[model samples]
Every structure is written in C-alpha cells, then in structure tokens.
Target: MPRPDRPTRPSARSGVAPFHVMEVLAAAKARQRARGDALLLCTGQPATPAPRRVRAAAAAAAAEEVLGYTEAAGDPALRAAIAAWHRGRYGTAVTAGQVVVTTGVSGALILVFLAALDPGDEVVLARPGYPAYRNTLAALGAEVVELDCGPDTRHQLTAEMLAALPRPPRAVIVTSPDNPTGTIIDEAELARIARWCAAHGTLLVSDEIYHGIDYGRRCASALESSAAAVVAGGFSKYFSMTGWRLGWLILPEELVGPVTRLAANLTVCPPAVSQAAAAQALHPESLAELDGHVRRYRDNRDLLLEGLAAAGIDRVAPADGAFYLWADVSDYTDDSLVWCAELLDRTGVALAPGVDFDAVHGGGRVRLCYAGAPGDLAEACRRLSRVTGRA
Candidate 1:
C-alpha cells in the first residue's frame, strides 16, 4: 500500500533529460523583465512568419471542407508531392509509398526509433548534436551512444568516427546541416556512412530537415546510397512552417508497415489542416518561396559570422548551412551556463549554452541562432560585444 502523502513516482525514461536552452531562456526572460532590456539570439526559431504561400495554403485548408483525419501514413497526394519535390531537388528517385507523414520531424524520429531498434539497443549519435536525438532515444528505451566530434571535424559524424566505436550500433543517427554546429556532411562521407551502416546491418536514420538551407554545396541524402536509411524532414526550417507542425519520413519499403502501425497507435495521423497546407508546401511556387527563405538564412549566417569575428569573438565553427553559429568561448569562461546566464542578465541578449548540445565540451561553448532579422542580428552582436566586455 502506498502512502497517501507520497508523491507519485516518475519512470526512468521520464527522467531522461531537459533541453537546457529552455531553462536558460526562461531565466533570461525573468532577468529581462527585471532589467527591462534584452535582445534574444538564443532561440533556434525563425523570426519570420510562415511564407505567404504557407499561410494562404492554411487559410485555404481551413475554409475547404470538413477537417478530418487522413491516412495513417498521410494524404496520398501530399506523399506524392513530397516524393516529387525530392526528385526535383536532389535528383533522387523516390515514390509516394516510401513516405510516412508524421506530426513533425520529432514524431518522425520517434517512429524511426521504434521501427528500427529494440529495447536496450544502442544507437550512435554525434555529441554536441541535437538534444532531441538523445532524449527521444532514451524515452524509447534505446541506449544512446554519443560520439564526440569536435570543431576539428566541423562537429560532424564521419565514417572514421563510426568505425572507431567500440561496437557497431543497432542504428546510427546522422544530421546533415546539423543543429547547433550547422555542419553539412559531404556526399562522399554520407555515402561511406550509408555503405558502412548497410554492411553492418545498422539502420541509418538520416535527418535532412535542413536540406534546402545550404549555402553552396548540394545536400546529400542517405537514400541516394542505401535502402536501409530512414530520411526525416519537415517544413519547419526551410519552409518557415514551424507552427504548422508538419513533417515526414521516407522509409524503406519493408519498414513502412511497422512505421505506419506505430504512427496509427501514437498519433493516428498528423493534423488534417496542417497536412493539407503541407501538400501546398510541396508545390513549385511554394518551394520557390521556401528557397527565398533559405537564401535569407544564408545571408543571416554570413552577417553573424562577420559580426562575431569583428566583435573579437572569432572562435566559431564554419556554418556551411543551418542558421546557428557554435562558438568556443573557453577564453572567456569555461562554464557556458554561467556565462550565458550572466550575459542574458547583463545585456538582455539570450544565447544557448553548450551544455544543451554537448555534455563534454558544452561547458566552454555557446550556440547563437541567426534566424532573426538582419538588423536584430546586428543589434544582438552589438549587445553581445558589450555584455562580453569585448565592445
């Protein structure tokens, strides 16, 4: 018999992790209210609203007939459109049957993990990688084996790094145009990793959510090299559709049934209206609007790099893609949590602590998102300079 006064116990998986950035932001918000001045550069969200087309699509969807659930996998027309988009963008031949629509890329990740791994199975993930990968894996009862890839490797996971792991993992998660670090794994490296995963029977979960946001080089798809890969993507980043909460997964034919079954049990299907808008996002005109957003991100990335360097905070990884700049702040402070807190308190400029991305060296670094307006970024840089005493 349990004591009436006792607190309910939480499961181990529930104790997995917290995204430290959220805490920092909360604290920063409090401090901002107290001081009444601050600029936020810490968030990974774009400051821009969803593109005109996306909004139009959503409005069109809302007005259009009864909003009801579509297929578990997704609306067939949307899947076909997504397949076609991939073909036009990457020159990769994909089919509608290979696509699995989910609530978001986050949902896609959970589905992929469920479809690929058993309880206690280990999956290799890059350290200083996206926090969700580790947290999601733990929640699903899978062991997350974190591989440390530092700035030397552009904070990317490579075939050599994978080979050095003590044992081959049950699956591996690779994010190109990765979060925090914003590095893109080249085609050769992607191919090598895909081949290695195939040879070792390791499922490859390739996160291509940042595909269209690259600066110059073409983004590589794991599906181009191996059939054992699960490609996760969404309209959040490139299409400026974060609030829409629409994303997708392209899985191998054999795993489609299991993924669909899991999706049916978990979400039943993504939101009907969002799915309808997502279908519009797949249109050529909508894609053109998305590409324009990507170009803006690229410009923001350039501005941030130049501004940070000019401010004497020059130690930053090359942000080939994605809208984040992972900077080494070891010279100023080893404890990034403290630094970030102090910086936020002092300047009202929010920044993500390295701890959110890397458990190892995260203490000495910080990640700044450049997804805001150019003027905001410039102003944030100025505030950062003053806050860091580098102005």
Candidate 2:
C-alpha cells in the first residue's frame, strides 16, 4: 500500500492563516514578563473593565441561578433586550425571533458563513480588512474575493467597486468603524452599497462590532438601509466585555432557523451566565458608563496622532471611528513584520504589522490601537520617538 502515504497528518482545511497580530501579542507578553515594561497597542481590547452592572449581574447569576445551557438560540430575554437595543439605536423594527446569540462575534461569523455560503461560493470584501473574514471563509471552502481599497477612497468599499467586480458574490461584508484602519463608510455610501447588494441578489453581512466607538460623526447601522442584511454585533468592543464571550446576529426570518440549527450543533448555546448578564449590559446606566470609555479612546487617539506627526511619521488612515490608527511606515522599513519585531525589542512598544490586514500591499504599514490609557499611549510615543531617532 506504499506505506499509506506516511499517514497524511493534518487536514488541509486546518491550514488557515494565523491571525498574525496574535503573534505580535504573544511577543509583547513575553517581553513584558522579562522586562516588565512592554506597551501593547496591537490588540483592540479596551483598557477599561466591564461595566459594574454587568459584572454584578454575572456575579448574581452565579450566586442565585443554575448555570445550565439555555435554548440553542440563546435566552429569549437576552435576545429581546438586544432587539430593543437595536430599535433604540437605529430606529429599526428588530424582533426577538430574529436574534441568535452566539459565543462571540467570531462564533456568529462562523454560523453566518455556514448558513449563507456553500462550497465554492464567493464572498467579496475589501483587501485591507479584518483577516478572520478571509481565513474563516477559506477554511470552509468559500472563495474570498478581495477588492483593493486604498488611501484614495479612504480605505473604504464603494458601490462602484461592487458593480465592477468580475461577478457578483454570494455575500458582501461591510465593516464600518473598520478594523486595522478606523475608517467609517459614509452613511450615504453605505446605503448605496446596500442597494447594490440587494439588486445583485447578494447577502450583506454587516459587522458593526465597533458601533459605539466613533471619533466624531455617528456611524450608521445597516438596518437603517437594508432590513434584509445579516447584522453581526458583539459586546467585545464598546461594552468592554472581550472575555465574556457574548455576541448576537440579527437575521432575516429565513436565516434565523438555519443559523440556529448550525449553532445547536456547533456551540449548543452561548454561555448561560453571559446571556444573563448581557441583559444588564443593555441598561441605561451601563450604556452611559460605556460612553465614558469611548471618550477616553478619543483622547488617546488625539494624543497618538499628534505624537506620531511630531515624530515625522505622518502618513495615516483617516481614524473616523474605532480605536486603531493605520499608519504608513515605509520611511522606516519596507517589511512591517521585521520592523515591528525590532521595535518591540528596542523600545518594548508593540504594534500590529499591516500584513495581517492587507496581504497584497501592507508590508510597509502598521496598525496602532488607542484602546488604552492616555499615560501608556504617551509613554509609548516617547519610546517610539527615541527609538526612531526622532527624539
């Protein structure tokens, strides 16, 4: 039997690209353990803790209620709370039956992909986007069609690009308050893209994970444009609940059942305590507290921008929303990975290389997240200035 081809060890689908920012984060952690001074601007996790009410609610649930699994689609109360939250934010008629809570936005994405895509189906997205979108779809045998988005368009996708694609995709993802680059698609332009997708018979997966963290102008939710879109949202960003493992997807009536069936087989249900606590997370007082965190992010962003310009590294993406500043570091090095590794070594300041976001043209770019305290950001800028010889 020819020795059975040496026991073909791993599945080909398991070879999805590593989310490289995680490697950067691992390095940062190691540097911190050794020197106790590393500054991490690589991940988008907020510096603040979860809201007090959320924490208290989780604790109360632990103390008072059984932590067994709820329904596969998640707790009806939590889903209802999420629907009400959307109705208040975007003036949409969101009903509880349309919501499916998942382990996180990552989990929601997997269910969404499984429900909407078949093998060989194509999904169109911007090139310099969240890497997981490509990796997840590829792992499931879906074709990822990338549109090149650059500075001329402020790193956003337009309806014109969708029309010009070789063929319409099975789905198109729109991330406002985008990852890596904090660019917000204009509300009017978003509506145009929504209409284009509708006309082309394509599913629109709107990732509004960073909804409440805009810099100046308010970002619009896709429900304001297309009620048919599958909206993926989570508590990680604005709610400061990264480790809580709670997120929800708002689907059209047709999709809810399919996605719920997938979730039943995949996750069984989201965490019981998390769904219980998330109900309190939507409280008015909790929201007000979360807004304060956004204010701190804005302050940190301003400081980093000024400091980077003073350090003579001026080429940057428009940080219209989100906590990341996508910076061009071509003046320093052509390869961002090497530059990032060396920068961490020399100054103990870690940032994500842009290759993680844009494999085509991101070797000379970097993304620095401002979801940290002002003091840490200022000290990081000081170290960067000194290390880059701009001091």
Q: What is the lDDT of candidate 1?
A: 0.86
Give per-residue lDDT, candidate 2, residue 322: 85
What TM-score against the true fold does each predicted structure earn? 0.96, 0.98
**Residue-by-residue lDDT tens digits, candidate 1, 123-224:** 999898999999888888999899888877778889998888888899999998989898888789999999999998888999999888888876788988
What C-alpha lDDT does candidate 2 achieve relative to the native structure?
Answer: 0.92
Which candidate wins on TM-score?
A: 2
Predicted model with the maximum lDDT: 2
Q: What TM-score quantifies how close candidate 2 is to the native fold?
A: 0.98
Off by over 4 Å in 1: 1-7, 31-36
* Runs with alpha carbons beyond 4 Å of true place in candidate 2: 5-8
